[model samples]
Target: MSGKRSIFEEVGETTPRREAPQGGMIDKGRGRARSAIRLWLMVLFALVALMIAVGGLTRLTDSGLSITEWKPLTGALPPLTTADWEAEFALYQAIPEFQVQNSWMQLEDFKAIYWWEWGHRQLGRVIGLVWAVGFLAFLALRKIPAGWTGRLVFIGALGGVQGAVGWWMVSSGLTGTMTDVASYRLATHLGLAFVILGFIAWYIFLLGREERELMQARRGKEAKLFGLATGWLHFAFLQILIGALVAGIDAGRSYTDWPLMGGQVLPPSIWLADLGWRNFFENPGLVQFIHRITGYLLLAFGIMVWMRGRRSANSATGAAFTAAFVALCGQVVLGIATVLYGAPWQVAIVHQVLAVLLWVLILRARFLSLYPLPQSIRRA
Candidate 1:
């Protein structure tokens, strides 16, 4: 039996209170490498962005078909000796791109284009290696957070598929009269690239904070706003694919006019009787027309999403959507400039890079909508 103690006396010794657990409350159950994983993803993000820029340059310079062969392991090392280069050049000379389009290219000229394609492939290999090493190390050490292993592996699987699709795209031009990869194939390749980038970006956002915080924040998610952003993202993706078609066929330079095509509501030769529906992808005027109209529609929808985003109680979420809309506006300006200037490599690459920026921005906005972060009433 225990004697009763005064209200504030040493009753603590008589009856023990359950103490809270030690260690970090926020990261209690999460893995220790959350920050490390985030850093790795950011590195991949930069590499992929660089890959896109280099790829755009390769296309603009008409250098994509230079290598004329796919050698995943052997191709990693570019030609080291003159004899090796000569053998490589011989292979390129046999392709339709060299025969019909670049027949005048000497060995030195071939070297220029070869370097671009080789560099693109090498960068891809480096990305694959980096991903493999980081992922395996995390998984082996059990450093990956619970429920994240499959998501990480999914990224690697997509990377492998991208490699195979890339080869398929290259093979299309090797035997045919086509000087460039088929336009639809190019669109597919580009669409997949953006998809990969989106996944990396979404994962990065999720990893920025601890798992507990994300769950807490999810309770306050703005559902309607999220729905709007989802629609906006899908619309933007469609526009991107259409834009790829325009680039694939050099349609951007076909008209070089805005608000009208060939000084008319529609391009004079907008339809190809023989190609029929294929005209949408193969015909330059029709493709650009669709790209422009899609741009207008995307902008309009973005504005609607942004307006709804304004109602979010969370300041950070609203700000993210505002940033996305600003990017969309700037991208429109760049698009107009790209057409006005005939899609020069300088302006065109910038346009392409801006598209990447806008894409990330939209994704960030979407993430914030799904995980509304509470903010201080006063500035921090």
Candidate 2:
């Protein structure tokens, strides 16, 4: 003003201004949405665990053979009236399991078992619907983060394939050759379900990891611990598969004693059958013995993992090790009880439930090890 310069020119000459970076709001919103997706995935994983447990109950109850038809849509709705009940029961009557093994069973008795099978199938339908709705919602809202959509889609496809596999398993028991599903098919189906659950759990872990802030603290040790945890996860999954084989062929029912079968450390003539390989998986006594041996091996591995973790008490890996140790002990006891109890429905179901829980714990340890939280964040 003293020099009589224009106001605008005076301001421009006094200071240069720079525009701040834009799009920060969008980035932050995207991050929040991704976090939400991660939490949702964890919820989905919990539901899967429940489904697996329920399926185990169904198997233990001998209710798998109750529902003889594959009616995806119509079967979703249970019998609403007496006529409907009769109609469903008539369909079951035609099945080999009913005609051959359970011909004396009355309609009322059939209904009791039918409800269990119906509940299992209905749960499957619910899971399918829930997955579909969640997926569509995520897609429509653009909530799923980049680099994850394809994996989720693949998981959804697997769910569909699992339905077909379920039917295929049921079909094996409907004909003249077998009264129950093929042990191989049963193992395949159970193994695939576990795989699907594992994938979901891992994806959730990845999502949570991205939201964490990076720290300057040393991570080399943590990284190695994570690798070890991942190994345990893989080993636990393999053990579960072997357990499934034991369940599929009723192997657990055949062997009641622990540490030894028929008063021998190694049951003599375990492979007495004509075909050697067939004996391992097919013969009931051999299969049971192998499963027992595998259990011992799994316990040994778990103990080693726990001990190594204990040696490094300051690390998160130690906590994971402790958890695996506890779970392994619980699982062993449950296995023994299940065997000693003649695989009673209740105890057997609990054993299966524990196996699934051990699997979840192993997965959680691996995730935590891979993406450790900074001490500052932990404290906060």
Candidate 3:
């Protein structure tokens, strides 16, 4: 009996029994919560995109300069009485946009533009309330996973900053020197919004891989591929910034011809202004030409990245690459059409929407590449 017991003990020592708990109901519950948060974040991102599109329409319609005041709180409510409309119109009449550009504009004309500006402000308010409520709910329920609380806080802070930046952009036009907000400030405001969107997408990816089994399965070569995908996602963001600059300067309004501007591969003179560097941003013609050249360069880079992704063994990567390729082509076409159509409000809005969608796809690809679906989930 002692000999048999010794043999059993030896066998037990040789085959190590893992005491670590297999993630069960608790993990599933956590996963469900994480998934819910991810879906919520995605919805929030879509709302943000809608806001951006509407803002672009506001700019294109010259409606940005229609409302001269920035009442952060009460401004959410639009004019409900004739007295209110008169007051709003009176305030707009004081600005240079009214004095110089729209002096002949009537109260009815003012209302046409006022509604767009008001709608934009109201959207900002809605976004703020949604973010605050969602964040608080997560904290109250202890649904946010460990290490993610800090990130959520950062996102909240960004939301605040974005509100401030929107006001800053509006303030630029209020001073009367320029009919529109400074293009540089506009780019900064848009760029920060994109950053917030990208961060939320990344957080979702992290939450989806909450299980140890999923994490282990995703380790190694798959992880490295995800890192590469993230790099491409960042590249797409920079391109969007450049696109914003193009919009801010009214750069797209200048050059209409595709593949050539005024029958030349390049603008006849790269820099026409006395100040060489200033020409890039201030000169609409030069700015448009530069934007076009940059677009082509970005297309080339995106194609290369997509091709490399196709060579990867991961099907997720292959799918991402294909989507990127298709999106880039569609975006390029929309961009050219926008320029040729003279930046019409409807076309311009669609162009901006497509850009946002492309950004979302790039972000999704990066997330999937970083964390491949676990074999069990993939099969399911």
Candidate 4:
């Protein structure tokens, strides 16, 4: 035999070297992009949370009506000169809030409140810009997942609506004998903020898992528990809105005593002679009474949900509900304490912050219920 070696002696010719299954390439890219988006959303989430806190402070300090004009784009720039400051103050002076409630304020005092409103609006602009930049960067890079483009865009839409809603709430106070924005309008604004926050948080939870994982997890979803958790979530949301209504009318300060309001289970008057349905919104007594009853109902509902959560085979899911229940308990305590203390800014802000915490915890619990993670045998 001639000593000619085969050229393919050292090479592997198995199956003609398939091109690594091109179908999964897109999915891999999508997974990575989804992760990046999730991180960006977390940043937005934190910013929204901070915005809520700042808004609470603005409300508590009676600084909400400091700016009389909407001026969304142009108002971004604050007063840069004494003349500018005077112009801004003059605008505020024309508002009913200044004419009726804050009449004793001078330019310096006006500046104090003006800064709060400006900072609140400025933070909103920053949130909007962050969302836009991140969403556009992903789109430019073609990194957004197949179904996520609309969701990302929706966040921006909601933010735009929120901005308009903010202006509407502000405009409510600028006319006629109104010293503050209507309580219903204030509730609407805060309700939308929490709604946006909820959606962002839920998207984050969904993106935390891979598509395959989420699909597989769906097979084992705890349907009944999910339903219960969902109900609890709705209940909690209602309570938050009621709390907003309470804050809008300074009702928390009205009922300083918790177990009893005004030395009785019910306050003396819940209605005024001329006003009929308006009293429910404008009357501090009725609003606070409604808030108190809703809080109690919320606690009972939380306990029920917690009992159901205890039965979850998945330890992580069970623990999430437990945490939510615990937060609810803490929030109730904070509410009572805030009331006992006449809703001072410090204590009241803490109360509002606890409401935020409770909200996120409930959302987390519900998400976990929807997509329960597998538990380790040892941990189980």
Task: Please tell me which predicted candidate would have the highest lDDT against the true structure.
Answer: 4
lDDT of 2: 0.77
Tell me how far the alpha carbon of residue 235 in candidate 1 is from the true structure, in angstroms, after superposition: 0.8
- TM-score per candidate, in order? 0.94, 0.87, 0.88, 0.93
Q: What does candidate 1's lDDT look like per residue over 1-380, in tens digits? A: 26855677765566878898874476765555998888988988888888888888888888888988789998898899999999999999999888898899999999999999999889989889989999999888888887789989998898899888888988888996888988888889888889989999999999998777789889888889999999999998999899889999999999988777789998998898999989988999899999999999999999999999876778888888999999999999999999999999899999899999999999998998898785622254
The candidates, ranked best first by TM-score, are 1, 4, 3, 2
| Native-to-model Cα distance after best TM-score fit, residue 49 in candidate 1, in Å | 1.5
RMSD to truth, every model: 2.7, 4.1, 4.4, 3.9
Error (Å) of candidate 1 at residue 250 is 0.4
Q: For candidate 4, which ten residues in a row score worst on lDDT? A: 18-27
lDDT string for model 3 (146-214, tens) is 677888889889988998998898788877467778787888888888888778766766666665644
Clashing pairs in 4: none
Identify the runs in model 3 with alpha carbons over 4 angstroms from their true place.
1-20, 24-29, 222-228, 374-380
lDDT of 2 by residue, 283-326 (tens): 77888887787788888888877776666534565576688689
TM-score of 1: 0.94
